[model samples]
Target: MLPSASRMRRGEEFADAIRRGRRAGRPMLVAHLKTREADVPPLVGFVVSKAVGGAVVRNRVRRRLRHLMRTRLTAIPRGSLLVVRANPPAASARSEHLATELDVVLDRLLRGRRSESRTLTDGRS
Candidate 1:
């Protein structure tokens, strides 16, 4: 289970991340990440729809994702929000596979963000 402080519980928060944040996708999951200017602990949310599976499968997948995410929490920037949506493929994927995908997508997303911020600062300095 994620620590309550690190979880995103509101619908609007999820919507903001999914609709306005930077996104990265893999065969098993899609990650939407939104950054804020303040330095606070990052918050994370997960979505596993019916298309992914029934209650049992969805819960299982959610638990696996939650645990996997715990390992990567430090990688997230302060005050940022992240939503991880599991696709149907996630229902059958092993935890290791899911972790691999998560790492890849997050690396791509965060690496791009770093370069973007650099460009912005470089232009002004």
Candidate 2:
């Protein structure tokens, strides 16, 4: 389980991330990440809708994704929020498949952040 501070608990938080964040897509999921100014650690939320599966399959997928995110929590930068929405394919995906997809999306997101920060710094002087 993720620590309380690391879990996004409020609907507004999730909405904000989805509304203002950059997005990365995978075969099984879509990730939206928004960087914040606060000093708090990153917060994460997941959406596994009924389209993904019945209760049992959805729960299983959510559990797998939760564990995957927990292990990679350190990779999340401070003062950012992440929301992951699972697609129907995710209900049938193996853990390895989910992990690989997650890695690809996260890498893209992090790379985008780095480039944006570089552009800001380069324009400054």
- Evaluated with lDDT, which candidate comes out highest? 1
TM-score of 2: 0.95
Q: How many residue pairs clash (N, CA or C atoms closer than 3 angstroms) in each of the candidate models, in the order given?
A: 0, 0
- Indicate the TM-score of model 1: 0.96
Report the lDDT of model 1 for residue 53: 91
- For model 1, residues 16-124, the per-residue Cα lDDT tens digits are 9999899999999999999988777999999999999999999999999999888899999989989999999999998789899999999988998899899998995
Per-model root-mean-square deviation over C-alphas:
1.4, 1.5
C-alpha lDDT of residue 90 in model 2: 95
Estimate candidate 1's alpha-carbon lDDT, on a 0 to 1 scale: 0.93
Q: How many backbone clashes does candidate 1 have?
A: 0
**Over the full model, what C-alpha lDDT does candidate 2 score relative to the true structure?**
0.92
Candidate 2 minimal-lDDT segment of 10 residues: 116-125
